[model samples]
Target: MVDVTELEQRCADAWPALVDEPLGGWRLRAAGGFTGRANSALTLGDPGLPVPQALDRVKLFAAAHGIAPCAHVVVGAPVEAAVADARWRVDVDHPGGAESLVMTGTLRGFATPKDRAAAVAGTPSPGWWELAAQANPTTAQRRVLGSGSRVGFGEVEREGVVVGAVRGAVVGEVLHVARLAVRPEARRGGVARSLMGALATWGLEHGARVCALQVAEHNSPAVTLYRALGCAEHHRYRYWVPGA
Candidate 1:
């Protein structure tokens, strides 16, 4: 059986926050509010304290980090029930959304023909960073996306302009893919699929077998593409915040 909890932890490490602290088995992460995954508490296994007490710690940690206290709770996981029992409700306005899916699959199928392949590099190109951030990237975005141990940055160019970009971070045997972006004028031309293929190739060279990604439920096009790549939901997580 695929251990969803273990995979979740691996993903967390792959997308590391600039400031990471542990509360027993849980992770309290912050990265200048760059993304919810970085700013929220990862509520998984034993926290080494009562759930309520642990949540108190989460609150304190968030306060110190200058972000709201939010717990990353997997749907149907025991910790989710405990957190809900502790009176924390969903953060309906979470920037990422209320829920997201962690999808996993092998890298073999994402390969594209060489001619249509994206160019993968060990470092992000200036254009890649700009497209991924939609602006000059904040330090947090740059660090969190580019600071991993073994990472690959992929991009597709058209008429001498970079039109697509993606990031892949290999953690052990798994490759975590994120930060995929394509210019509005570049969509519908298989730019994303090409970048994914190149990322998969890079991950394979780095000894990764499975690929994973997180996507919001409402992103139908992305969901469809990933599904076509044979990725399936390993688990789903939601952000919970202080509420009744």
Candidate 2:
């Protein structure tokens, strides 16, 4: 069986929580409002301080960023109980925040789509960012997507414009996929599959053995697409926000 804990750590490393401050063994991350993975405190292990004290520090750190205090807790982790004891409630209503499923698949036999071609760049191009982010992306969001040690920005052009985009970051043996998006009018056109295929091919060329991604449990369409690609759930996590 794959070591879920190690996989979690790999995911964290692959899509780094930028501007992280360590409080004991916990990571207090803040990256504007990009994503919860970069904006919430990560309870990875023993915090080296009392649970309550660590929680207090998290609150202060989030307050300093002018964001609500939040913790990204792996499901069934010991820290989950501690946070619940302190009155933290899971954000059930937050889109994609209630439960995120980490999925993984082998890249050994992956092949690029024959009919679709993608332009791969070491840094995100203007078209890639515009398509992937939908709106104008903030500097922090760009850094989160493109600043990894080994990153690939894949864009599918249609009619002289980017219609699909995805990001792949290699960390050791894992290729973490993120920021996959396609234009609304381009959905159901295999744009997403082409992007994934291109990224997987790029990852294999760069020595990656496995591909991984996080998707919200509520995103049935995305879940079905990834499952069809042979990815299986490796783990799950949820965001725990302090009760108002």
Which candidate has the highest lDDT of all?
A: 1
Candidates' lDDT values, in order?
0.89, 0.83
Q: 43-113 in candidate 2: lDDT tens per residue?
A: 98878898888998999999898777888888988888989998889999775558899999987545485
Model 1, span 1-244: residue lDDT tens: 2488889988998998988998999999999999899999998889999999999999999999888899999999988888988999998888778999999999988766556648988888888887887557888898888898898889998887889999899988999999888999989988998899888988888999999899987788888999998899888999999885
Clashes of 2: 0
User: Ten residues in a row with the worst lDDT in model 1?
Assistant: 108-117
Q: On a 0 to 100 scale, what is the lDDT of residue 29 in model 1?
A: 98
State TM-scores per candidate. 0.97, 0.93
Tell me the deviation in Å of residue 21 in model 2. 1.6
Q: After superposition, how far is residue 244 of candidate 2 from its true place, in Å?
A: 2.9
